[model samples]
Target: MNHKYIAFETIVIKEIRRFARIWLQTLVPPAMMIGLYFVIFGNLVGRRIGEMGGYQYMEFIVPGLIMMSVIQNSYSNVVSSFFSHKFQHSIEELLVSPVPNYVILCGFVAGGMARGLGVGIIVTLMSLFFVDLAIQNLAITIAVVLLTSIVFSLAGFINALFANSFDDISIVPTFVLTPLIYLGGVFYSVELLPPFWKFVSGLNPIFYMVNTFRYGILGTSDVDIVWAFLILLLFITLLYICCIVLLRRGTGLRS
Candidate 1:
């Protein structure tokens, strides 16, 4: 095999195996959390919350929960995995090798997508245990899910590049990612929000993601579904360009 191909294959495979080797950390906990959310929020609190957009609260929020797992896991996978390589100084080995930066970037992003999509699938299956799902549009469902994964994976790559310490790896997820996901129409419809907050929430990227997927699943949405796909594609391309530039410049790669 060509050296670049070998490196790409090795790096991607290593990333995949890393998660597989620790299924407990990578997979089980998220699935269990999904189950808990269904029980606590969907069954209990959701009953009091009543119907949203014509569906039960549990059904209403399933798309958001799935999108949330997809976003968090995808982003976390690349940030932690790539940053670990940097921390161990192994990135230097690849940087000095013949592998193109693009290959390296794709390999890690591929790994992140794998973890993200894996979690989404697991969450979706778990959601079935709570209520029957109605997938209104298959194409929209897959497109939005894939786009959400790609965007967040790139976000994770950028964060990993900027991260200097273990704590640095978490700042984006803690401060930025969490708030965005929560306020992204997970529990309440934006229609019920104050006019000012409604306009502000419109700017939330996750809102489009969850809304588009919700439209696909339940045939109900707050935003134009086409706009959601366009927004996600725009972010994906922009983020990919940024990650490529950072890899070429070796930003934060050296001590």
Candidate 2:
């Protein structure tokens, strides 16, 4: 095998093992949190609300919740792991190596995607306990989730590249990512919103992701799935370019 492929595989395996070893911290907490959401929001509040888009409220929110877990875990894995390597000055080993920039970027992005999808699967199984999830379109469900994971993974990579401190790595997810996911139609459909508010919600990119994934599972959506797929592709391309440029420049990786 080529050395570059070996290097890429090494980085990905190291990242996977790093998070797996800390499964209590990395995996179990998200599962517990989603369970609470299922109990409180899915059972208690959802009962009062009734159906959303012809499915029970719990069923409706399943996709969004799963997507939410994917977005958070994937982004967190890459940003925190990459930033730690940078902090420990261990990233210089890869920077000084002959591995191509794309390989290096993809290795980390793959790591992020792995964690994101891993948590997503766990949450999806947890959802099955709360609601009988009959996937409306299996292909779309997988495609949307995979694309969403890639977009956030790339976004996380860029965030890590620009992050100078640990706080910098976290500020975006807390302030920006959390708000967007909350407003992204996790609990309620945007069709219920007033015109002005609906127009505003249209601007949140995460909205498209949540709704599209919801459509995949429920066969109903507020936005066009094609448009959502296009937007996801655009973001992935742009973020990939941005991450590659930062890697080439050694943005936060360089002292």
The segments of candidate 2 whose C-alpha lies over 4 angstroms from its true place after superposition are none
Clashes of 2: 0
Error of 1 at 189 (Å): 1.0
Model 1 Cα RMSD, Å? Answer: 1.3
Q: What is the lDDT of residue 220 in candidate 1?
A: 90
Q: What TM-score does each of the candidates earn?
A: 0.96, 0.98
lDDT: worst 10-residue window of model 1: 246-255
